[model samples]
Target: MEKTNSASRFVDLVQTKKSFEDIKYWTWSEMLIALKQCQESPSLTNSSIMLKKCIDLLSQKISLADGASSSASSVNSSRFRSSCDSKSTESLKTNFASTTWWFEDLLFFSTECLEMFVQSMVSHEFDQVLLSKFLIHFQKSKFFNATSDVKMKVIESVIDMLDTLDENVLSLKALFDILRVTLGLNINKGSKNRLEAMIGSKLGHATLDNLLVPSPYGANYLYDVNLVLRLFKAFLSGGINQASPSQLAKAANLMDSYMVEVAPDPCLKSSKFLALAKVIPDSARKSYDEMYYAIDLYFEMHVGMSEEEKEKICCALNHKKLSYEVRIHLSKNPKFPLKSTPSSPESQQPETENLLQNINYSKSLISWPHNLTEGINTDEKEDKSSEQIVLYHGKFDLPADNERFKVHLEGMQWRVLELEKLCRKMQTQMRKILKSRVASSYCQVKSLPKLCS
Candidate 1:
């Protein structure tokens, strides 16, 4: 009986040792399971303990992964470098996948707990102060440079909370801080491509429309508008050309709507138009046509713009070549208005009955080496064959800006100055001619009188 009792104690001791070892060497999957069990637990205190334990493990794993990545990069050799790169990429993928799964699970668990706690507090069954304390503690916990997935999940949760909760209850600053934190993260090309795919996905994965649709007819509308605008500006500016065409268009459309309704400032409106004009893809013919339409729209919208704004618009227009039809439209508008008195005295004009009367408008404005009338005659296609050949041969050496207004004005001034100089020279020559004729006539009269005497 004594030997049997000792054997039973030994087995119990062995079992205890194995359990402790298992907890000591917890795998990522095991940590995830532990979090899940905590999420299902009825006791909040026990669940909190379990959550803390899982979070600690996650932090350690992330630290280990980051340290490994940093260390692995130091290894260098032409032969081994490719092998190392492959291994590192595979390791990163595995780590990213695991972290993404863990983040999603945590988000689900936290949101569910938050909702339940909020309900309990409303029913007076949960302590409001305690709930507040829990929130504060959670907020202050060290994230240890969390992955993008974690950041995105937090942003999504904050947005969801703002959408669902009353404005009076949520701290707007805290929510904004969450978004700012996400935006502050380093945006590499790989991340940018993923974000672009998300924004442009026809399936609506991470679609901006789905994530940040504006509210209607309330303070919430204004709130949402500001949030969405900030989010887009940060994204577009940070990523620059990373956005897909459809995504770019969608963002532009949203900003345009905001400009029309919320921001009535002409300069602000013009800015949005400029951004839209820049983002349109110009590689394909269809996209080029779309850009042409955008340029026309921008011109139409900014008709009465200030000189500075017009200058900015002109600068942008000069950056890209417009289609033939668009160029024609631009010629009708000409360039932005110059000041009545040009900065250069040479370009300044005197007031006259017709300021442009002396100017050869057609010759001054047209940069072409050929006849203006022939160029204007769209029906004379055969006559333009040479011009077309030159254009194609030169790979379309088309100028971007409408230099017509400035060139025409300057040319007219120059021609007027030349004509005035010529007139002065002619007057001097004519005066000399008259003087010689008078002298000859006087000599003839005097000689005739002497002969008569």
Candidate 2:
């Protein structure tokens, strides 16, 4: 009964507010207090009423502000009775301009109120009407033009609701719809950074990866795949270097999925791979594997390209050996099988035979200086069936100073070198990917109709 009176009084206060001062003096403190009471009480009927009143009050203030600013030229001379009344009109505009700070504050308070209302609804597990209204307003309202800090709070609230365990999947889906709409805005830089940090903390690998694929939002509202890609790019490039390992792994998985979902755009794919490589910690073996897998999958998908197209890609391939940093990690268990196949059978056989037959793979290095030819003892003979001469770049050191340990180390080093070859091939593949994109872009431009500037 007390909650009912409080709710009725809140509605009366809001409906009676005619100016900024009235809103400030009438609702702010009383509304929060009434909301708290309603939260504590078993019935949220009053809380919902109070929240709706606040929303309506905010909308009324915004409408007044908009009218004051926009009607300056549209007002007729009859509207101002005399010079004194004209002064009053000018004063009204001045007051609206001066009260711009109230706009941001109102938005911030509304978001807070909405967030509280959402929490109450989720906790009570009732009041779908309030949730539905909030989502609709958040999705389509002009309140988004408020200050960056307010925008950040709004996004923060949505993400908080998404992270809440009490929130059902339907509520989550509604929040996602809100996010998809929110993300479409040209958010300020500060808000984007804050948002990325929130996403890293809240949205994990699976969530991000699922975003890469298009989600069907019923027959009327199909989720845009391009928008999801833009969001993914924002998450990655928006200070993603500071993301945690788990976030990095999720980003890697998202990139992998992006490769498959988007049409064959080499530049986009390569950029994602390079970005993933830059952020992924060297210790993140699973992410590295995903990166390689994505790259290998690209090559596999494009195996049907013409011979000329293949040459165009392969011509950019770098024959440079792997760096020492990569070689060291190669010796660790960071190796994953390369899923790439050669462009042709003819190109495949020689490379396969060369890699397999010649245990001294380093000696077969094409990038080696021609002046170092004399260093190779061509006259040396080896038992092909028995003692394979393994080339060591420098002295090997192990904690155990035993011959058996030395043999094991040598074998591991050999495998590492083999992995190094694969890494180099991947680097070459990266160059090819970049070149292919450039070539494709050029062809597209050339195909376009010429126009006068």
The TM-score of candidate 2 is 0.32
TM-score of 1: 0.29
User: lDDT by residue for model 1 over 1-453, one digit each (tens)?
Assistant: 644443343334334433322332444444555555556653644456445544544443443443322322233222223333444446545757442322333343465544443343333322233333334334334244756666554444434333333333444344433434545444344433433323332211123233343333344233244344434544555353565655565555544343334333333355654554444233311223344344445545557767777555455443233444454555454433443112322122232213344343322333222222223453464445444434333222224433444456567778767766665675566567657766887978643121111
TM-score of each: 0.29, 0.32
Q: After superposition, how far is residue 368 of candidate 2 from its true place, in Å?
A: 41
Superposition error at 408 for model 2 (Å)? 5.6
Tell me each candidate's RMSD, in Å, in order.
19.7, 22.5
Give the candidate number with the greatest lDDT.
2
- Point out the worst 10-residue segment of candidate 1 by lDDT: 340-349
Give each model's whole-structure lDDT: 0.42, 0.44
lDDT of 1: 0.42
